[model samples]
Target chain A: MPCKFCSEKPVIQLPNSERKLCKSCFIKYFERKAIRTINKYKLIEENDHVVIAVSGGKDSLSLLHLLKKYCQKRNNKIKLSVLQIDEGIKDYRDISIEDTKKFCKSFGIKLHIASYEKETGKTLDKIKKQHKKTIACSMCGVLRRYLLNKYSRKLKATKLATGHNLDDEAQSIIMNQFRHNIALSARLGPITGVKKDPRFIPRIKPFYFLTEKEVATYAYLHNLISKFNECPYCEESNRFFIRDMLNDVEAKYPGTKHSIVASFIEVLPLLKKKYKNQEINSCRLCKEPTSSEICSACKVKEKIKS
Target chain B: MPKIYLEKEDKILEVKELLVSDILKSLKINPTTVLITKNNELILDDVKLSKEDRISIIPVISGG
Candidate 1:
């Protein structure tokens, strides 16, 4: 059969004859593995609805494709809605939202688009206006997650799926270590925390094992994955520097990255026992579980003028 | 050029004796918008930079 994504002619001929995946098989494998991970983890419980944060990037597109494939195979009419949060950064998010819409439309997935301005009553530009010392990219990240959760909860979603892949996880581990943040680092794996509250929807990473290269390849073979390169505004992110630092180290040290994360996971049971002291209590203001008076999202939203 | 080291790569990059804002501008990052570590401390983007600094940037990582 022709490749499922692009209606491209055929994907039977591998450039390297010895390769196991024709271009199509290559793409399918990544999506299949993602599905396998989700199923294996039992991440999707019955009566659970999911809100996918589709960033119109390679990893997320592949993730959505796999989720659709999984739903098809299992004949589960699961309620999945793709939420595209536009950052209001000129063409960057616009292009991405368009691609996300196209992918969702092609698959018949229900979709919702929330622009920073429309949803928040303020644009990222406006947020930047208020906070001069802070970078716009920084606020965008915070707002996206905050809004994603708020919207997901309002929609009654039981969980959230993001397009974070293996490299993303590994990078986070190394960066956290480099920053001496063992506590936060420990929580950066496939399943974060299960705060089993009605208001909180746990997030799951289905692309946990797959590498960055695999995700990119899947998107390429699938074709037209909204070609927005790195954001012009976020290159200064210290994470990018850490990313550069980890590049050679990860390659030379082999499982060095994975082991760092694995070590954290290994110690999590003990770590929580030793360090996690109190039962999760509600934010003093919003009733969200937090170590502080207000949840991070609520605090950020407090910045937006009503 | 100030010798800002991104030692995780174990090599030094020649950065300027610049303010955090200029550096972020050069790096394409908007400041106060992401996490910045200098010599193991989270430094503000407004802090001045010198040759002897080791820096790493971690945006509030949200994956998985």
Candidate 2:
């Protein structure tokens, strides 16, 4: 097969790496795309440190790997760090953190792991008990995001990067729209970070244009990603079902992921215009950007206690 | 359309006794990862969805 990144002739697809690009343009094009994403979405400014929300998962790992390669290729001076949240999901958290640490160690990125138990004196399993039938990941997610923004700001970083790819974005858009969340779908387009607030550490998804299969295939081909499957605690997530359905759609439509991503660009501007009248205020507890008085993270924690 | 917590009208979710996968399928969303909740209850049903319920679906996120 021809190299996926370029149409240069006689390019061979290697079976042992995350990319199907020719060796010549691989680094250059990857860096260009990263830069393009930033420029396209205005994710980060030059000379700003970036903190990656590393999960040690395929998408996140792939994002980190490509970012490093891109940064080095561009000789960008932005400092990088890998931050991991310890949700204390028994065997799962332990293995995921170990893998993240190992990858960061080998790849030479600074790694930070904040345990949920350590921060709040409670683990996710314990927190789940506070709310009956509430999926554990929800509470953990809010905390992780809160911490990421907090720590990112504490570290004086300019932006936070995550590994949300095309499939992920699609699921969110559909879910939000189904529940009359047009504003949420409005915020679904590609970007390096959120534009609403500065204290919130704008988040960017460089892989917004990529698909889950491409990430997995890249991980599988390159021996890059961790061997673990999805976290066991995520069984309650609607994304799993959405994923299977999208895969079936892709099998029939071939390029659905790209189409969905493309659609976001078209819809995002209009959604923003429509929701421009909505009021946003800072979270009272954390002083971070939020529409609510107390951010969801703090509220969830308070719920856990009360 | 129940009393769902609307996160500024963006991250809408259906919190029912329905399976996470079923909701995703119904919504035509490709699942990456998400957090589900309903009225402070931890729902485990994958196929059952009740009406007049408050549900939340947060996108899969990871950070520290």
The ten-residue window of minimal lDDT in model 1 chain A covers A11-20
**Model 1 captures what fraction of native contacts?**
0.00
lDDT of 1 by residue, A218-252 (tens): 65556634333455466646666766565456544
Residue B29 of model 1 has an lDDT of 53
Q: Which candidate ranks first by TM-score, i.e. highest?
A: 2
Kindly report the docking quality category of candidate 1.
Answer: incorrect
- Candidate 2 lDDT over A1-306, as tens digits, reads 445667542122221233445435544544466568767777766676888988777778888887777677558776788888888777777887888888999889999877778767788877777666776656776788788888788778777898887778877777776688776675566653224666767778887765554454344334564334456677676666566676667646666756776777786777787876666688897677677788888787777775
The per-prediction tally of clashing pairs is 9, 18
Q: For residues B1-64, could you state the per-residue lDDT of candidate 1 as single tens digits?
A: 5455432234556677467667767766533224445654444455667666667654322211
Candidate 2 per-residue C-alpha lDDT over B1-64 given as tens digits, one digit per residue, 9 for 90 to 100: 4434433235555444245566655665443333334653323224245576666543333222
